[model samples]
Target: MSMLVFFFVPAVIFLTVVAPIWLILHYWTRSRQNKGLSDEERQTLEDALSVAERLEKRVATLETILDAEHPNWRTAREDDYRRGGS
Candidate 1:
């Protein structure tokens, strides 16, 4: 009975306390490791956003030019594109 109690007490304590603490720390560290983008990844994202903004500005300028030169240009081009007349 004493031998059984000794083994069982430690086994229960390990399972109930040590296991949960170990699991929590393991997952916590993993989450910290995965939390942020690397410098290269952040730079790539910034480059993509910059390019997108520039393209948007260019498109807006082109649309303004087209509006000045041909008022119904969008309607006409949209119709042609919809009809597969690119």
Candidate 2:
């Protein structure tokens, strides 16, 4: 009871006043200081996006091939290799 009594006022003060001010200041500073992507970073990001797009196209092509080769390949979750016959 005494411990609770000692902590209650400080906790209330922190929750009501300190935490809100801290959060506001933190976010405000972050927003103010946002130096968006540098030239190198931007170029790297573009390259990465291009690579990702190419990979996606390749995957689609592979899937298309698999689909044509075996129409039921998508539905077949084969566990034939399992020791206890699944």
Candidate 3:
């Protein structure tokens, strides 16, 4: 029984205290070592940026077309706003 106590107490302390602390520190350091955007996240961000650029170009083209078709379009809009015409 004395022999059992000698080994069992330390084993219990190691399992209940030291093991959890070691595991927490191991994972904490591992996560800190690999802190950057993953490949999939980077790809998604790039795709979104490209789509935004395309949409911006489309809007500029449509605005140019509208300006060519209606030279006084902006003044007409202001007059309509003053008269409360929708």
C-alpha lDDT values of all predictions: 0.98, 0.89, 0.96
Give the TM-score of each candidate: 0.68, 0.52, 0.59
Which candidate would rank higher by lDDT, 2 or 3? Answer: 3
Per-residue lDDT of 1-86 in model 2, one digit per residue for the tens? 99998999899999999999999999999988776887899999999999999999999999999999988776564544354444
Q: What is the lDDT of residue 78 in candidate 2?
A: 59
RMSD of every prediction: 3.1, 9.8, 3.6
Off by over 4 Å in 2: 1-34, 78-86
Model 3: runs farther than 4 Å from truth?
A: 70-86
The true-versus-predicted C-alpha distance at residue 77 of model 1, in Å, is 6.4
| Model 1 score (lDDT) | 0.98
lDDT of 1 by residue, 1-86 (tens): 99999999999999999999999999999999989999999999999999999999999999999999999998999999999999
Summarize candidate 3's per-residue lDDT along 1-86 as a digit string, tens digits. 99999999999999999999999999999999789888999999999999999999999998899899998888999999999997
Tell how far residue 68 is off in model 2, in angstroms. Answer: 0.4
Error of 2 at 62 (Å): 0.4
Candidates ranked, most accurate by TM-score first:
1, 3, 2
